[model samples]
Every structure is written in structure tokens, then in C-alpha cells.
Target: MAAGGEPVRLIMSGAVVGQELAAEFGPLPPAMLPVGVQKLYELQLEALGGTRQHLVLPEGYGLTDYDRERLARAGVEVAPIPEGLRLGEAVVYALNSIGAGEGPVHILHGDTLIAEPPLHADDVIVGARRSNEYAWAEIETDASGRITVLVDTRAGEEGREHQPVAAGYFSFSSGVELLRSLTRMRGDFIAGVNHYAAGRPMRALGGGRWLDFGHLQTFFQSRLAVTTARAFNTVRIDGLTARKSSRDEAKIWAEAHWLQEAPPAVQVYCARLLGFGAEAGRSFYETEYEYLPVLSELFVHGALARQPWLRILASCEAFLRTCAQLSGGGSGDAALKALAADKTAARLEAFARETGFDIDAALSLEGRPAPSLRAIAERLVPAYDLQSGAADSVCHGDFCFSNILYDSRVRRIRAIDPRGLVGERPTLYGDVRYDLAKLAHSIVGRYDQIIAGRCRAERRGADFSIAFEPIACQPWLEAALGEMNVRGVRGRSVPVQAVTVSLFLSMIPLHADKPERQMAFIANALRLFLELDSQ
Candidate 1:
């Protein structure tokens, strides 16, 4: 609430200079960029507290209806101001356009977030941090922490050794007073902010745990800090190496083996295995660290045009083809069947036993009748068979978008986090269909988006419905899948969609940590099955 007993309004400025990020991380604005499992806007909303908030965007920004609906659900109103305006001008334009009443209004920069925000209704406050890396305004505070001056560092302000710089958060006592001060300054954001501070007793609040995504270097640094780690593994990253340790010794050992034994065709597309050891009864291995964007982020949140996405898929297809050609083993029909029918059945049973949600019953998906999980798995076995004399290929068993990293500079991708084990045995070879199924699950199934919270599922016993946020990449993904089907594995038809559905069903017990995720997996599995059953 404001000092006047009205709800405090927040105007979040997302119209920062973001050409560098756009060129590297696809075409989305900085606020919409995916960082780890959440977008920057979602993280900002969680950090900045306010009941009513307006996200100020630049003109000509193409926000999809699904994106708008998601933002509205989070209680954020989108406000677009004139393009190419100065930060101060944009903020003023948004405030005026939104008709912010004469009450306390808080301003937060979209590219930054403060972990422990120190905002109060009594006085105006500017959040400041001790950093000199990026172009941030320097703040001068009096003995009582009252801000006396704000120097715009981007305007050639000489350094006096990295003092407290404004970290892009502000609190105002009166909206009308701020408007007058900003109007007098005439589009000079820093000057207008200084003018407002001069009139009011503006104080400096030292920001604690500030995360900046304003610049390229700091963007990757902050993003790496928040990357979610899998429950079974612990990864420690340094300047040159990423060390992965796991209590499950077999998992770690198999991963190391796969990395080391990978042929040149596959090894060229993977991180080099550095070393391995044991400590404190846990197994550990290190890999060369490369700062690259995850493939899932680009596909889910990136606004890149169609051709670029198709190009990436083409590169992936080439890699998969090479995997089949160079690393073929004996025909593993029995292994494939066991993975599809036996493993899925056991996992589904375990899922029901643990969660008390029986998935063996028939479900309705998108108003279409879908059969039970067991029946789906049973029918999916015929699709799991590799054609006669076709050898099993050495595969990155968990070849999903999340496990793949893309280097935009070279237009190349690297695969990480291989499944490593095939039926409790440490081996680099598996049914090529399994790898195809994994990729299918990412694109056609939209599993990565679901993990990133871009999906909704409503479940009541045996009935379930699911919907994912519509993305621009959908048609491109469909084209890629169509192309993949035309170029079948080893000149034999592959049941990628059927095997993909089975993958989702079998992985339910492993993701018990996130019940929502488990349900989402089931819901998605049903959706895919409905499509297959109709066909």
C-alpha cells in the first residue's frame, strides 16, 4: 500500500538498450529472455513486491496473445511506450499513459533484481550497488544515506573508484511531484531523476544480493548462478571446468565412460572429459566448461525467425545421422522392447503406488478418449523395433533440448547429460529409436516448455486436459519433424511419436520431486497418445 492508503503501483521499464542480447539470444527483449527455468520478468515480479504492476515495453514489440495472457495471470499489465525514447522519457510516457494517480509509485528496471529490497512508504529510495562493470549511474549519498546526486556513467562520467551505483530501483512519494520534475528535465532520465531527488529527501538503499542482466558478461554470469541442478547430480562450475558429482556412482561412471568412449563424430559435439575421481564416498568427473546458451531457451523463449530454427534442426539431424552411421552395434530388439513395455509398466505402477494417482485407467485428453498408460505402452512396442540387420547406435540417450547447448556464434550445438546406462549396464550404445524419441519429446511433445512452466494441466482422477503456451517455433518444429520422418533412421521407418509417449510415461517415477511435473508429463503423454490413437 502507498502512504495515502492506496495500492502502490509499480512501473517496470523493459525498454533498455538490448541489441547485443537480441543478436546473441534470439530476438526477444531482455525482460522476456529465459534465464534458467524462469523468464527475467517472472524473476523480477517475484523480487519486486507490488499488487499492481505495469511492464513498460518498447514500441513494435511483438508480444503473443499467450504471452499477454500469462502476464495478465501474474497481475502485470503491459504498457508500450514510444520506441527509441530515453529511459526517463519512456518511464514518464508509461506513467502518464497508464494514468498513474497521485500516489506512491515504485520503479524497477526489468534487467535487474534485488534479492533483499529495502523499500518503504515514508521516504523516496533509490536502490544502489557497489559495481563498476556495466554502465550504471553513480549515486552520491549524504552522511544519513540521503542521495544528493546521481551521475549517469554512460555519459562519460569519470570514475572515482566504483562507488555506490544506482541499481535500477526507485520509490517516489508523489506521482504528480515526480511528473513535474521529469517534465522539467525534458527526456534526460538521469537529470530528471536528479531533479526529483533534489526536491525530495531521497535516500540511498544499499542493495543486497543484486542480480544484473543488463550487460552480456553479467547476463551469462547471473544466468549461470541460477541454472537449476538436477536432484540426483551436483555440478560445480569454475573458470575453465565444470565438475559433476553424484551419490549414484554408476550414473557418474557411465557418464564419464560415454564421454571418453564417444567416437570422433560424436565427441566433436560434446564437452571434453577432463578427469574423474572419488571423494567422501561419492564419484565425480570434470568437463571443459563452455559458456553457451541452452537449446531449450532458444526454442521456447527465443523470437528468432523460421529459417534460423530450421538450420539448427538440420545440424542436429546431421549429428544424429552420424551417430547411427559410425557407432552401430548388434540389433537390440529385445532391449528396445523391454525399455518400452516392461520399464514403462514398472514405472507407471510405481508412480501410482507413490502418488496415489492411478494412471492405468483410461483418460480424456483434449476431449478425446485416450487409452490407459499400459495399453499405450503395449501398442508402442512394435514401433520400438529397429529394422532387420540394423545395428543399435551409440546415442546420447537423454538428447533433449535442456541437455543440449547452442553456440550462436558458430551455429553449432553440444550435447551433455547423457543417460549413459542401458539396462543397468554401463555402455555408450542404445536403441537409436530411444534417442529419436528423446528429441521428439522435446520438439513435438514440448517437454522442455512444460519444465519451464509454459504448460497448464487440469486433472480430476482419470480425466485430464493440458495446454501449452503457443510459440512461434511450432510450425518450424513441425517442419523439422516432417523432414525427419522423410529421412527415416537407417532407411527404416521409426516410430518416434509412439516411443516419445512411452518415454514420458516411464519417466514419471523419476520426477517425484515435482508432483506438478509428474502430472504434466502424464498429461502430455496422454495428449501425444490421443494424436497417435486417432491416426
Candidate 2:
């Protein structure tokens, strides 16, 4: 930017994101997933000095009110990228529309993850590679690192001359001069840079934690990278107030302790990832959410149309069906099994507190005879298709009332904080029944009441018991039961028992900071285990 001149930045997010990545998370539009813990779009802004530049995104790519508000919070403007324009033209169009006025315009790919962006006043498009694989734009650079021969092809062979890569990211004095050469550009970032490189050569810089969001494999790889970080960003104790919904008619809240816990790249993907994992893989569980105008809000005000049971059920159905249709079907059984066999009980004990029962004692019951968890798993394994994720199974890894948003007046509901996968792995269709079990836990286990402090628990040595208020969300309970058919779910209601038990274990993280809740959760797990074993 010139002295005393305003700065503008354009991010070309209109280019549809990878289909595989979208399918995993279900109907997620481009630039929605995270690179580390932050959303791709946010990553761009963060990389480009967030809130400093007047930001703009491409139009015609329909955005949700939630998305708009999120961007608007940081001074971003949206503009239309003319139809049938190339990537080059889109940048130019955004520049003209943004009207930053005679200053440098920085352009970035909406989905690219730039970790250590070394921003400078130079014409360059940069990316890195793993042993020269999947180069977006094959670049041959001179000893001085100035790009010499550039072609957007991965064909033929490779050598030191054709180094680094151009990963849909660049800096232009202004895209104005590159427009005429971009008449037919479509989705190609290097094409526009190549056009401008006719006279002024654009260099290729590599290295740093740069990840190309070019495909599904890379996307998941990025997700795992965040997960595997030794110094990963974990949950922090923040007193931040909750945000209101896009409609402004409700509030969205979560445990401040559990919110914003993911690595910087994927942190905004959801409220929080499962800092605690169980017998299921290290898949993301209930991230956290609190919907205001909560059911209690409407109930207290007398504006409730009726109990939101049906709407909640309908919302669950809609969410599951979408996951099923979007899923293709695949299982990381070996990975899943290894992932599920968590040996981190000792670590969790730190977060747990003494209650009616010992969490350690409850945990020791795993693979034991009295609890006979093996038998419960035997019955649930086939029913839930946990191992294979067969063609018909798709799950909402965490399906419960806490993750739901409901409007009593309109009788509408929306589910939030999904696992986004059956077990957070690849699948055309994951275990559909998986969601059924989770939803059932809320209804049968009286999970919502427990969270709301309406349950009682007692423990005597090896035996544990819980007394929950008779469910009041009868409509929702019955409808969800009918949908998942968990009433006769397994002989002797074994599936419900087993699923509820799993939920008991899964919920440890929600109450990680509370000893009483942790013991209650563990006791419930034991109670459910005993119930399943006997019946």
C-alpha cells in the first residue's frame, strides 16, 4: 500500500472447495473447513493482517446469514465475480468492485492455508510440495528464485529447475493490467499470474507450514496436522459471552471452557472438538452449543407452540438424511480400532472429581465379566455397524438436545456441533444408525435433564444407579424413538443400554472440570453397563 493510501484485499472463495472435503462435513460450502483450527477464509484474513485491510469475497456463491455476519465482524465486503470469468478476471473484478483506490491489492485463495506468510512487495505466487507431488502450477525458478518457465501441468518429469509450486496465492500491484489476458480463465490461479508474468516475472517461494486445500486427502491431512500438534491449542478458561444467532432472535452459547479449543486453523470449525475421546475413535464429538431462546425461554414466556419434540425430531432426521446422502461409504476400521482403544484414562482422571462413584473404578470395569461390556459390544457392534460403516449407516457422532437449536413459535429446529463424520473418517455413507444411538441416549438416559441438574445418582461399591426425572419432551422422545426405532432397538433394549453407556463415557469431557459430574457420568456408565449385562 502507498503512504497514507487505503489497503484492500480480495480472496477468491467463489471457486467451489474440494467436493470430498465438503461431503465429509455435509453441505459445507467452500472456505468453511479449517486448516489448523481456523476456517479457511478466516485463515486468509489472519494471514493478511486481520482487520487491517478492507477485505472482499467473491459473490454469486450464496452465503448464509451466519457467514455474512461472521465476515462482517471483521470489515469484509463481498463483490460479484462476473460469470464465465477466469481466476485472473475474478481478482480484477473484485479489485474494481472493492474500489480500494490506487493502492496495492493482495489476493489469496480462499481455501489455502498460509502458516508463515512472508508478505513483501514482490510479484510472486507460492506453494510447497511433498516430494514433487500434485504441483498446482509447475514452476521452474532460476538460482535467484525468480520463476522462469511456468506451466500449470503435473505431466512429464521433474528436476531442480522446475521447483516449488504456485498454490492459488499471489500479490499483484493491482489486477487491472492482468484482465485482458484473463478473458477465459476459470478456476486457474496460475493462469492470471502467468499472464502478468509476460513482462514482469513472478517468483515462487516455498517452505513454512503452507498447506494446499486442493483435495480431500490434503484437507484431512491438514486436519490431522492440527490434531497431532504436540503444542496443540487446548481449551482455555475464558469468560467470553455467547454470540447471538444470525436472526438475532436467539443466542448461541457454549461452555466457555470448551469453546475455541482447536488449533488456530480449524478452531472455528465448531464450538470445540472432543478434548476427550473414548471407545470410539478420536473423532470430534459434541463440540458445544447453547441455543437461546432455549426451550425453557419460550416455555417460561408462554409463546411455545407446543413441546418442540416433533421439530427436534424433524431436524435430527433432516440432518441424518443429509449426512447419509452426502456420504459415499468407507471405513478406517484399523485406524478406528486403534484410535478407539484410548489408554488415556490416567490423563482424564486429572479432570475428574470424586462423586457417587469412582471414575477409575468404573473404567476398570471395561472388559470385565460382571459388566460384560464385551457382550454389550457384541450386540451393538452389528446393530450400529460400528466396524464397517456399511452402505446404510451414517452418524451424528454427537446427537443430543444440547446441540439442537429450536424455535418454539415456528416449531423449527436445527442441529449443531456434529462429529461431521461417522467416526471422523472417510465414507460415502457412514454408520447411519450411529446417530440413532446418540439421539436415543438423550431421550432414554434423560441426558438433557441431567445436564439441566434434574437427575439423582447413588453408588454402592460395584453397583451404580441413577434416578432421572420422567422425560417431559415426550413428543420429541417418542418421535426420535420411532425414527431410530430404539424401543425394540436390540433384544432386551440392549442397544439403548449400550448406547447410553457410551454416552456416559463420552460426556466426561463436558464435565471435565467438575468432579461431581465426572463421577455421575462414570456411575451412569456403570449403571447402564449392569443393566445391559443382566437383561
Top-lDDT structure, candidate number: 1
State the number of backbone clashes in model 1.
0
List per-prediction Cα lDDT, in the order shown: 0.76, 0.48
Q: TM-score per candidate, in order?
A: 0.91, 0.47
After TM-score superposition, the amount by which residue 478's alpha carbon in candidate 1 deviates from its true location, in angstroms, is 1.9
206 in model 1: Cα distance from truth in Å?
A: 1.3
Off by over 4 Å in 1: 1-11, 14-17, 62-70, 121-133, 142-145, 154-158, 238-240, 332-335, 356-360, 485-494
* Alpha carbon lDDT at 37, candidate 1: 68
Model 1 whole-model lDDT (C-alpha atoms): 0.76
Model 2, 332-446: lDDT tens per residue? 3332231222212322343344332334332333334343233333334433334543444334455565555554344455444444332333322324444565666666555
For model 2, the stretches where C-alpha displacement exceeds 4 angstroms are 1-6, 22-29, 34-38, 52-60, 82-84, 130-135, 155-162, 179-191, 228-437, 440-482, 487-535
Total colliding residue pairs, candidate 2: 26
Question: Which window of ten consecutive residues has the lowest lDDT sum in model 1?
Answer: 485-494
What total of clashing residue pairs does each candidate reach?
Answer: 0, 26
